[model samples]
Target: MNIIKFSAQFPVEKSCIEHFKAQRDACGVVCPKWGCVHPYWLQNKLCYECKQCHHRQSLRSGTVLENSKLPFMYWYAAMHLLTSTKKSYSAAELQRQLGHKRYQPIWEMVCKLRDVMGKRYNLYQLTDEVELDNAFIATLIAEEEKDKPLKRGIGSQRQPKAVVVNESSFVENPKPGKKPKRVNHLKMLVIEDLRADTISKTVNEHVNPKAELTTNDATPYSKLFEQVKSHHAQAIKKEDLPKTLPWVNIAIGNVKRLLLDVHHQLTNEYLQYYLNEFCYKFNRRYFGDA
Candidate 1:
């Protein structure tokens, strides 16, 4: 929602808190101590107190807002702004919008949101046909050296590896002038190393066992077959890249442009969070207007 709509929906802190409580209730807040899935919500204290063990848990307990001293409205507003656009707000920009005196808290909050986004995406696996590819994203150091005084070539900075997985389907019967391929869902993983073990582990974690994997890496592809049902070794040439890996390529390019616009310089340390926000928005693109 836009700021106007957000203000209309959440007029006050209490409204935001109530909405958060409702969402927590929908998720079935459990007694963390007793393992009871059903817990009685104490309206007076705004906490879930256990009947069996008398364990009292606050509304923010075990959620993204846990231990956060900021007001619920801040979080609500942050979430609104973050989800309101495909191009995300940097912590600096978010701090400016929040009108907070300190920047540390706002920065931490943005990082927390990004961290959770990545973790939430881990709950589901890609199914059916999937096209897998690796792309080397230019890191902050790499981008920084582009304007170096010494024009005798730039120094080498490690480019981060991104594993891009997309749900792919080819049109069996197509109408005239229509594209023959379509890409649905997508997932991206930023890994430290590009070893076969790392690639296999990430692929196994993200892609379903029954899905077909297509990639250029013959060694890793063969290894992934044992993890998944089938593997197709399709080496995508430079000309066929856009056609073969449509969604991931577009997503990567979009993410790079977004980071460039928002942060100016992208770092390997926090690139995953940026990826998380992009993937999160991309996954929910059908939600219409802000």
Candidate 2:
């Protein structure tokens, strides 16, 4: 939805509260201690109390908003701003939009929400046709050296290589001079090493066992098809790609865009969190108005 419609529908504080209540109800409430059924109490107008344990729980008690001192309306506004746009905003930008003088609290809040979004979604499992590739991300190591020469290797480098695994599912219309359209479901993994074992383990963890894997004639992926039923290796130069594997190219393009646009630098320690966000957004790209 656009900003205008979003503002019109969720203008008041009460409306935000109602929206939260609806989401909370749909997700259900359980006794925090024993995980028992906790039915909503309409009279209370906040949350359900556990019948057996008698534990009182708020809708946001155990969620990402737990212990948040910010107003519920503000929280809703922040969520709306974050999810409403395809373009990403830095903490500074968010702070400006939020009209807050302090940066730390707002930054922390945005990071927390990003963390929640990271945890809430699952990656697409490639089952029929899959494309696999890897890319390196150049990240600044220090604040002082942010603008230092990167190509000359002057600044400390954090090479967090990412693996791109995509599935051909829903094909879009092909453009002129473009390869055949393939519906691609993509997942990116940030790992320590690109060893055969590491790649294999990552693939096994994310993709289903029945997936048909496709890759360049890399020795690491040569024996992978043996584990699954169908693994195809195309002997193409690194520069030249096969026409059938349009999904791989698209996935790579998306990764580059994300790195250059959304996240400027990613350290190995926090790479997974960023990848989680990317995967969540990619998976929900088609969930329009929902």
**Candidate 2, after superposition: displacement of residue 1 in Å?**
1.1
Pull out the clashing pairs in model 1. none
* Tens-digit lDDT track of model 1 for 228-274: 78887776787876666666777778877887778756677788888
Candidate 2 TM-score to native: 0.81
RMSD (Cα, Å) for all candidates, in order, is 4.1, 4.0
**How many Å off is the CA of 283 in candidate 1?**
1.3
lDDT by residue (1-290, candidate 2, tens digit) is: 77788889888878887888788778877788778875647545476677787777876787888877766776777777777666566667777887878887776787788777755644345677777877676665655555766444222255667788777753478677756646555677777666788888888877788988878877667567755668888887745664656667676676567767866545556666666666666766787778
How accurate locally, in lDDT, is each candidate?
0.81, 0.70
Q: Give residue 101's error in model 2 in angstroms.
A: 3.0
| Candidate with best TM-score | 1
Best by the lDDT measure: 1
Q: Which ten residues in a row are the worst by lDDT in model 1?
A: 149-158
Q: How many clashes in each structure? A: 0, 1
